[model samples]
Target: MPLSTLNKEQLSAATAPIGNNLIIASAGTGKTSTIVGRIAHLLQTGIEPSKILLLTFTNKAAGEMLERVGRYFPAVVVNKIESGTFHAVSYRWLKQINKNVTLKQPTELKTLFRSIYEKRQFKRLNHDVEAFSSTYLYEQYNLYQNASLDGFDIWFIDKYPDHKPLIDIYMNIIDEYEDTKDRFGFVSFNDLLIKMRQSLLENRREMQEVLVDEYQDTNTLQSALIDSIQSNSLFCVGDYDQSIYAFNGANIQNIATFGKRYNDATVFTLSKNYRSTASILSLANRVIERNERIYPKKLEVTRVSKNYPPKLLIYKELFDQYQAIARNIKNSYTPSNDIAVIFRNNASADGVEASLRELGINCKRKGGNSFFEAKEVKFLLDVLSLIVNPKDMMAFIHIFEYGKGIGTAVAKEMFECFIHFGEGHLFTGMLSPRVFNLPKLNPTKNMQLGLFDDDTQIGSISRFAHLKLSEQIKSNPILKHPKLTDDGLIFFKNFYDFLKSIKNVKQPQTMIIKLINTPLYEGIVEMLSNQRAKLKSGEIDPDKK
Candidate 1:
């Protein structure tokens, strides 16, 4: 905890005059350590802990900082330092004042976009528009909002005149999305910063200092939010060379222009390498020096030099390269060696994995395949859950949608009914006499009916059970005798029979196999087969497989 223990540059940075300071912290340098020391120095200098804010780019980094502060300082210092990601801190601040804001998750946003697209009958492009909307459009929207631009559509059309038709369509989607969110009183992840900045401008909070980590990775909105919140006292630490998040709207110029933007900002460079040898540092410096617009800082290695240059291997083909790699691992590595073969993409590892297996080298993949995401595994689990607890609406919905007549809309309605009532409510509601006798409305007045027919009321259970109920209504003489279309006797009988058949099936594998052999699974298999055929015929990229 002593300030004297830090390197001269670190100690100076930790205890520097705290008026708009930027620390260019290189990789392998003690950036986090410097930030923690700075916080400790501030606390030791009689600064109110609550008036100091520490922001990171991730929850994990924030947590790590908190943990380190706790380890190095007293509990009082740890408790008073407000620390979190930018979005988290902004959201917490807004929530404290009772803002009626809802944060849309990525999945929720994608679903909303898909729903709007389907309803509007938009012409489909070959590219994944949902993905494009999320990544490119989302970033551009935030940038536009940050810059206070009101006419992004016109700007985009003017910029890309050749693609104006598609751009116009996209602009409509964005307009519809904005209108929808406004009507529902919803806010997105980026809206948190926009609103936070607005609130701060109206009524600035009493914060004496703001320290941001990974400043180079901040987007324009985040940078604006930081500027709004910090009252001439800012300490940002990041390396411009390490900025690689431009795809997500990270503006490297934020770091590059810090001094110019904050005219009185003091800048410091921390370029001492502590983790790597001199040879490695030299090689890295040589490679990065080629960049035309780099911050001029040379890393001085403090560790003992390995004295050996890095080795490079070349082969004629991917399989040959993988084979050589496998041979090298088999000959040079032991079971205890902590080695990794990193690849740019998961598909690139196929040849390496095969080669490694041929050489009998055991390796494990880092990520893939959560048990719940596997189709066969999830189906069986859903069935088991339904059998054990019939009131499990999620499980019931999944199983129900597998039937012939049940689609997502019908299943959602069933789920809603189940939520309002108790177990087996969906079945009872579907079979109710009230639903069967409901009068239909005009088509124009029944836009809310969704995929159902215009004559079908919202609660018309028989219409939902079209194929499933019609088959039973004709095939079973007993069901026909009940005149029970009004009572939903036929639908109830069919549902109960289906549930009962799967209830006592003790062997999950057998149940899974049986389910796979059904029409639903056959359809899925055929779709997959057609996709593979397309890939084989060069209509689709094999790498996408």
Candidate 2:
């Protein structure tokens, strides 16, 4: 990207003396092109690649910028420029001092917190600690660190005074967790930011210039982390109107006050809109202008050609909305150019996808995994597969994975043993456990378990006919596998009871209501419901999976 190729505003901003520069770039205004031009101008001024640092929200953004820069400079020179997200760069900095530094994801940290929490004698506390789920408390601990620098106790007390009673215990638990992390050289995403700032406070400048992307969508904690950088120059590009992460702790004021924070900051507006027509920008401006303006800005169209005005359509039902969209797209869509159907939530996406399919239009998704691809869904499907045909070895092995201490290899071994005992079908072998009397296993224990030699192993084998499912599980030859454990396998026993109840029913449903009515499958439903109760804030079933 050459400086001459940039618009006048972009050129001025890119080549301006770099002290404290803030580029107020509106959406689709070639912000990336300005950044590219800026990079070229910096290199043209003979600045060393290592002295320039580019910080992006995602590693992919940094990689894209570098790849574009590489086209203008030698690969060796381009690669040397420090480029990465805050977490990525901080990890490298922290790793230099502690070779054992390790990063843990939110899921892993939550599990760790729960384990430590369960060991405490919270029952004795006047405040019912059990009232708050471990997941909710863990999310709050993270929320405090990510959103604010205030003391967790103060923050919790000020916002959720009712939770004040249990705050001390949570604070202690979190303190213990943090100490454990430090002792083990473990750091979460927020920890990397927190520790890196502390490190920078004690160090001299390493990079002379630091560039921050998506400044408007950064939280107070992140903004503080950026301010702690010991760089001589700061280049931040953001559009306050584009800020959309408030729910995740993003502060709109970070960008709004950038000029005031850096008194010498020079502001430039990238107003030329390359992506939208004048009609769209006009409506956009009208809608956003109604909001309070911390820093005034507007979008200007680049193209002089006339374009279609934006249309607003209303529908009475959600399904009707999707149907209308699908009908319109079906008539105008070109095979060479794909049409996009953007939805805010997965549930809306599902509706649009179904409508499109009904109209015989082929579409593919790009964001998250499909609904059927979830682990729980696949597990349920496996169970359904097993119910349809007990001889399904694959389904058997998959379901067996839920059994405590049973891996794929062990499950496979169990499957073979079941098939061998059943003589052909898995249910036949399970219904009759007397084959264990042949004795590679304990015969006296089988007698103790009330599992005896059947009248015949061919059909309707004898095994705990007089006992309940729980008793049968204890005596079942398959469940008593030498390699299997005694616990987690209990769920499988419940599933067996389910299979027996529905053995004669032609029509079966996976509905929770139906499952809860069964004495056997009700346990599975309850366990799944408990798992769902652990969902984090703003997490839906799709995102949870």
> What's the TM-score of every candidate structure?
0.71, 0.69
Single out the weakest 10-residue window by summed lDDT for candidate 1: 442-451
Instruction: Report clash pairs, candidate 2.
Output: 422-429
lDDT of 1 by residue, 1-545 (tens): 84656798888899998698999888888888899888888888889889989999898998887788787787876888788999999899989865666676554454444434333223333333322333455555555655443487775656556655466556665776676566545678877888888899898887889999999898777888987884648999998888898877788889989989997888888988898877788888998788765567889999884576778888889878889989989987456248789877777788888888998998887777698776555656776676565555446556555544443334434444433333334444333322332222222232221222422333333333555445433333222221134333433454555544555577767766665665545554454555665755558554544
Instruction: Choose the strongest candidate by lDDT.
Output: 2
**Candidate RMSDs in order:** 7.8, 13.5
Q: TM-score winner among the candidates? A: 1
Native-referenced Cα lDDT, model 1 = 0.67
